[model samples]
Target: MELDFILSKEEKGPSGKTELIYDLAIIGGGPAGMTAAVYAARKKINTLLISKDLGGQVLWTTEVENYMGYQYIEGRQLMDKFKEQVRHFPIDQEIGEEIEKLDKGEKFFSRNSDGEIS
Candidate 1:
């Protein structure tokens, strides 16, 4: 998967905004999706991670300590760290965006509610 275009605010405003193309279009930004973004970006793939929320599943938890390196930390705190790490790369992250559809092509395409392509 590869991202071919990033819908600019101007483009989205005029096109009835729809569809996006990406090398890797991850639908969620939980630990899994964010982690994938980190790896995909490291490999130099055009990656886009669009999620309704940044920390999926894990955000609801009060505490988490079993993962690694940290003796104890809140779930939100850990997820924040994960997000920060992924941000170190050139991954295109779209938060608070809900994916209405995903069409796989030579490149993956995603459409959000605002008709903007990610």
Candidate 2:
């Protein structure tokens, strides 16, 4: 399977820098995180989703048979379905990237110092 770093919106600042403003920031690309991002986007919230990999452990699984919807499904295939839904929205993703440092200011959430969000 091919894992692409799906993304858009460069968001360069005055000096070609990135902005550090987001109403929502998701740090994982698992089912839960993706679901959160989908919900946030549906609400028209400014959100950024960063993750080292898209499927996480789910991609390593040989088969997922217990899930309600489908009778049987391969891990990679299921993940692709999730990815399809995710791609339907304008969700920004930082694939193959990990959060190195996190700093919280006087604000509500912290920014990704490495420009993952900031």
Error of 1 at 49 (Å): 0.5
Which residue runs does candidate 2 get wrong by more than 4 Å? 1-20, 106-118
Name the top lDDT candidate: 1
Local distance difference test, per candidate? 0.75, 0.72
1-118 per-residue lDDT for model 1 (tens digits): 2235543222232347644455666778889999998998999877878788988999999998767898888999999999789879988777887878767765455677887764
- Lowest-lDDT window of 10 residues in candidate 2? 1-10
lDDT of 1 at 57: 93
Model 2, 9-90: lDDT tens digits are: 3355446766445666788898888889899899887677888888878899889997879889999999899898999998
Candidate 2: count of backbone clashes, pairs at least 3 residues apart or interchain: 1
C-alpha TM-score for every candidate: 0.70, 0.73
In candidate 2, list every pair of residues with a backbone clash: 13-17
